[model samples]
Target: MADILSILLSDSFWAAALRIATPLIFGVLGALLCERSGVLNLGIEGIFVAGAMTGWLAVWMGAPLWLGVLAAALAGAGFGLIHAILTVPLGLSQHVSGLGVTMLATSVAYFTYRTALPDVTSPPRITPFQPLDIPLLSDLPFVGPVLFQQTALTWLALGCVFLVWYVLNRMSLGVALRAVGDNPDAVDAQGLSVYGLRIGAVMAGSALMALGGAFLTMSAFDAFFFGMVNGRGWICIALVIFASWRPGKALLGALLFGAFDAFQVRLQTEVGAMVPGQVFLMAPYILSIIALVVAARGADYPRALLTPWFKGQR
Candidate 1:
């Protein structure tokens, strides 16, 4: 109990929580956009892996770090387009298409990584993004370091929460998006192209998802590795449900998950041999499952979710 309390009160623990949550926030916001448009993007996990690999590869190949990040976003957008084609125009099963995409993306990343660095004698590395301390904010007590001192991507992720909320609640595009998610046929009756809107949302959302993956290799760690994403994509799916599909709520959910993850890491170090490290590692996932169960009943899923839309078919 004393050890847990000490760790909880430490500034470093909270800081780590924000750091861990950054990618989850990006992923949840991305998933939120696609799901809100009546599309269940299962390709997110693949896009994430693809982004991490492509971003790291870009930096290794001598491109600027920002350019690498852009490359990752673009790669994610490309995959999103493929998913849009499969689920929207082709009228395929969203679940199958999404899973196929994940398999393809992850496989392609592994192949590319192996081909590029065939000799694993020395793994490639890059100068990852470093933390930047916000002047006045970082100087404050308690909240300063935890909230203010983080990488640029972390700040951008925080901004994205607000951006998604504003776009979903305050903008005309948001209204159109929500309408399409609830009733695409009605949206079509109003002369808007449901396909176009969905495609746009998927691509845009995927770009953000890839950016999250890029953060893993470019900011979170200096090198890319197999299984680096480690099910964060799946966690985002549960988070979207837990948040009731709202961006603000998603932020809180991400933080909550992140807190569990951070605490578990601390717990493992404090308990040492008393508790197995795997148990601590499993805490976040177990909590996620429980959260999903609790939140599932009240989740207001999009009305048109997982439904294939054909213009003239009733």
Candidate 2:
């Protein structure tokens, strides 16, 4: 057991853990934004898939990798607009609208990927985003690769965690957003634009979702595939509740889940003589369920979450 623990604590293990956690961090960030603003974005799966496909498509078009990344963010925002249209403007059920957006986005991603890039047998693999090797720190033994030599996106994700924490806690916009989530009517009574704040929150959430997808295609996998998101969206939803709408906690949760996933894959490979890989693969799902259960016990979810705020409703 000590030997096994040592292997798990190796630099390579930590590096792989960070790599897997990147997408979750992005998704959780987006989820944090949406849920804090009283919107439950069940469409995270769709947004992720759309971003992957679009980012891949852009790469196929011979565009710069950064352009492909930007395209993914734009794709997310577009889908977010659709979500806002149905749930925010039309007063549709937030749950149904979110699911609908997911379904529609999924179809769009599949058909477009197939029809437009028919010759592509698999998702076109591109260069993984470049890693930044810190001059002094990257040379340190054991922890360098894991902490210092990660792709630019990893650093960005970390920065985003802090940025979001600040924005949600200290900024004026954050206060207004919380006001809208807690009671839009009161926010309206103050003559603030509830609609505008909601729109901004949705767009912000969608952009983060897109970045998460970009991490999968442009950094982690270097390619996209059908249903590539594979229920990660649901995981993000659970993570948001588990983190209690806190950005720092969201980052921590993502890393913990990522470590679990990394270990599952490693265990399956190392102990194939004893256990089935599928069982290990299911570990992350089990963790998600456990988290949801714990969070549901005494969670402080947004008071107005999933409640449609019609302008005319007093």
- lDDT: which candidate is best? 1
Taking all chains together, the TM-score of candidate 1 against the true structure is 0.97
Tell me the spans in candidate 2 whose CA falls farther than 4 Å from its real position. Answer: none
| Tens digit per residue, CA lDDT, model 2, 1-314 | 77579768789888988888888998999988988888888888899889888887898778888898899999999998889777776768889888988898889988998898779775667776887899999989978989899988898888889998899899988998888888989888989888888878988898889788888888888777887788998899999989998999999899988888887777777787797667886788899999999988889988988988988778
Backbone clash total for model 1 is 0
lDDT of each: 0.91, 0.86
Tell me the alpha-carbon RMSD of every candidate: 1.2, 1.3
How far residue 249's Cα lies from its native spot in candidate 2, in Å, is 0.4
Models 1 onward score TM values of: 0.97, 0.96
